[model samples]
Target: MLVTGGLGFVGSHVCVALAEAGYDIVALDNLANARLSVLARLREIAGRRISFVRADVRDGRALAQVFRRRPVAAVLHFAGLKAVHESVAQPLEYYDTNVGGTLTLLRAMRQHDVRRLVFSSSCTVYGAPESLPLTETHPLRPANPYGRTKMIAEGLIADCAAAWPELKYALLRYFNPVGAHPSGRIGEDPLGVPNNLFPYIAQVAVGRRAKLNVWGGDYDTQDGTGVRDYIHVMDLAAGHVAALARLESQPESFTVNLGTGRGYSVLEVVKTFERVCGRPIPYEIRERRAGDLAQSWADATLAERLLGWRARYGLEDMCRDAWRWQSLNPDGYPERPVSAAETRRRRSRRRS
Candidate 1:
């Protein structure tokens, strides 16, 4: 199987799960938003060496070469820019990487007669939920470019499936994926600044950052802050396995939500992190950013019924695992190990 962006947070965990399930993994990544060292860690956890392809999914020739060389059973496309604020600032890049790259991949898959795919979609496609627990049939009114790209990709996959009658696809729309592998050797490593809440709280707990900025404290929620359905990375990865099994058994296209069907406010997360890390997570209530929602959770009934999968971890597990990664790797995979030369380069880049 081919796994794009297999070195990333969710992607890496999926690779580990897939490897344990006895799948031969060909991991393709550009390392733009991930680190090369992550592949080593994945090998360590997976207990086997995986084939690594250092190529971008947007490069048609490079992607085609992989298909030409091997008989890929299926493709798990996870290579894309996924920052909400960054997507707003650079809409074209996001579209080119997310939408355009997906198109390139689909064409290559079609060329090679590989008609099976497991796409990494997001719950952002739901926008603000019309009701409490969002189902797969919920209206897709994405409010941001990030979500728009996902919706577009889903449409493209559907079109591709229609064209190729044998094509099987599973679009797994995930909620907030937090936590790390229990081994603590691999985790989420966002470039520059993190756009998610858990990483920011982990940073504060680890003393890498000053405090957490609780965005939007005036929303109509339990704590007047935005509430999100945070699912553990492992649980989310297992859901992918289940989805793959379903796709293999029945060659049909489907979309499902992978979430715990529970919501937690910002304060709730911070307090949980404090309990997990044994450090007070100092935070400030800031203004609510535009396009933010009040509360969003999933109706996981479809996943449970179809894939026979349900999220098992809660807020405490998420915080504890994330804290383990943050505390162990506060610097988050530095290029060089705290040497004077590395320090000078970091300082120089900051000044520039």
Candidate 2:
């Protein structure tokens, strides 16, 4: 198995799952948004050493070299810029890395005759859902540049599969992935300020940041805040393994949604985190942001039918595991000794 972006949050977790299932892993990552130390953590978690390739998917020659050196069975493509807000600011970069990078990887795969792939797609491809509980058949009208790139990449994969009947692909459209490994050794680590809700809230709860800014609070939802389907990262990782297993026997192309089929509002998440962390998370309601949806979840029945998988973790587990990682490593990987005053500040802010 060749897992791109293996040092990242989702990729690392998927590596652990794949390794545990006795698959040999050859991971390639650019280290632009991830840390090399994550590979060490994965090795520790998987109880085996994994082959590491420090290269980007956009580098065609490097990708070709990897395929020539190793007899890889399948590729799990996870390398891409994911921040929605940042993509809006840097549309070209998003397209270059997400779409162009995939094109490069696909070309290399085609050259090597390694046609099996499990793509990491997003529910964002659905944009603002026309109806609740989005299904795999939902129209894909991506709102942001990031989502648009994913949609286009999915299209490319579909076309490639159509052109070559031998090519098999599984497009796993993921919901909002949260939580960390229960061991707290591996987790999500955004380079700069986090754009996602869970990490931002974890930072506030851990005192890395001040108050959590509920992005859009006036939405027509239960708490007037945007609602999303938050699936545990580990569960999402397992879904990938299932997708691969299903692909092995069927050898057919498919698309499925990996989610809990339940939605949680921003305020509900804050309350859950407060209860789990035993501290108050001070947050204020702000204006609804453009392109923000009131609510979005998934119809995960397709995944269950196709991959024999369904999300088991609930919102509390997501919060508890996330807090474990945040509280343990106030500063993420490359664990630095934080001063007592800084730790106290984080704790004190929760009281405010």
Candidate 3:
């Protein structure tokens, strides 16, 4: 299998799942927002070396090279710019990487006769939701450029599937993915500021960051804060495996919401973090973030009915594993280690 952006936060966890499930992983990542040190950790957790390719999904030639080297049965395309705030500032880059990258990858797959894909989509496609427990049939009205890009990519995949009857695609619209591998060796190590709440709170607990910024504590919820369906990253990873198995069995395209069918408020998460880490998470309520939804969880009925998959981890598991990862790598991952081949090549160039 070929997994684009497989070294990223959720992608890395999926790599561990795929590897442990006895699948030979051919992972492609540009390290644009990830770490190569993660590769070592992935190996540690996976108990085997994963073939790595340092390349972007937008480059067709680079993608084709990866395909030439391996007979990929399917692809899990997680390669995209995903920050809602960043997407607002850089819509072009978001569209280019997220939409254009999927186009380039699909074309390459068609050429290679690899027609199966598991796309990473977002619940932001629901756009503040007309009702609670967003379902797959819910109208798609993306609020941010990042969400817009995912909507566009899903459309493109749907169109491609319509044109080719043999194409099998699974569009997984995920809610907030939290937690880390149980091993704690591989987890979310975001570059710069984190857009998600899990990493932000973990950083605060680890003392790397000063305090957590609670975005808008005036919403109507259990604690006057937003509530979301935060699925554990490992459960989310297993959902991908389930989707892959389904696609391999049937020659059809489908979409599902991968979530826990439960909601947790921001203050609830902070309290959970405090309980798990045994530390006070200092926080100051700030203005609501733009494009922020007050409450949104998943129905997740279709995912369970079709894929036979449902999230197993709850808030406590999420908090405990996240704290483990944060304590282990308080400063995030170390600098990328140099491979022996890369070191030798540099030395030879210097000698000449």
Candidate 4:
């Protein structure tokens, strides 16, 4: 199996899960927002070396070469820029990487006769949910460029499946993925500042950041802070493996949600982390982010019914595991020099 962005937070965890499931894995990444050292850590945890290719997903030539070199039975697409605020600032880059990358990948898959795909989609696609406990049937009305790109990519996959009836895909629309591997060997290590609550809080707890910024304290939630469905990364990773298994066994293509089906408020999370880490997470109420919704959780019934997957971790487990990773790796991943190839790619992107 081929796992794009396989060294990233969610992708890396899923890679471990896939490896444990007896799949020979090829992990492809540009290392744009991940560390090369994670390859070693993954080897240590999975007890096997995962083949890696360092290339951008938007590079069709590179993708084609990967297909030609390996017998990839299926692909778990997780490559793309994911920051909501960053996408608000840079829409074109988001579209080019997320939507354009998906197009390039689908074409390569079609060319290679690899029909199975498990897309790493987001609940952001169902922006500003009209109803609570969002289901797969919820209308997609993405409010931000990041969300828009994912929605567009999901459409692209659906269109390809319609055109090529042999294609089988699963669109796993998950909520906020938090925590880390229970082993604490690998975890979410976002570049620079974190845009999500879990990492930001973890950083603060680990003394990497002075304090956590709690966005919006005037929301309609019980705590007056934004509420979200936070699923453990391990649970999220298992969900992907399950989705892939379903796709391989069944001829039907489907879309489902992967989440805990319960929402956690900002203050509530901080309190839980404080108890787990035995430290005070200093936080200040700030203005709400531009593309954020007040509260949104998942129904996740379809995921359980169809894929036989449901989140098993609670908020306390999330905090405990995240604190373990952050406390162990005080400064996230180690800094490494940019390769000549990566430098060239950046320059080319700048010129284009």
The regions of model 1 sitting more than 4 angstroms off are 336-352
What tens digits encode model 2's per-residue C-alpha lDDT throughout 153-215? 999999888888788999999999999999889888776788899999999999888998887
Which parts of model 3 have CA positions greater than 4 angstroms off?
336-352
Predicted candidate 3 versus true structure: per-residue lDDT over 293-342, tens digit per residue: 89999999999999999999999999999999999989888875445467
For model 1 the TM-score comes to 0.94
- Per-residue lDDT, model 1, residue 240, is 88
| Global CA lDDT computed for model 1 | 0.90
For candidate 4, the lDDT comes to: 0.92
- Stretches of candidate 4 exceeding 4 Å from the true structure: 342-352
Give the Cα error of residue 299 in candidate 4, in Å. Answer: 0.4
How many clashes in candidate 3? 0
Provide C-alpha RMSD values for all models, in order. Answer: 4.9, 7.6, 2.3, 3.8
Candidate ordering by TM-score (highest first): 3, 4, 1, 2
Q: Spell out the clash pairs found in candidate 3.
A: none
lDDT of 4 by residue, 312-342 (tens): 9999999999999999998888765367587
- CA lDDT, every model vs. true structure: 0.90, 0.91, 0.92, 0.92
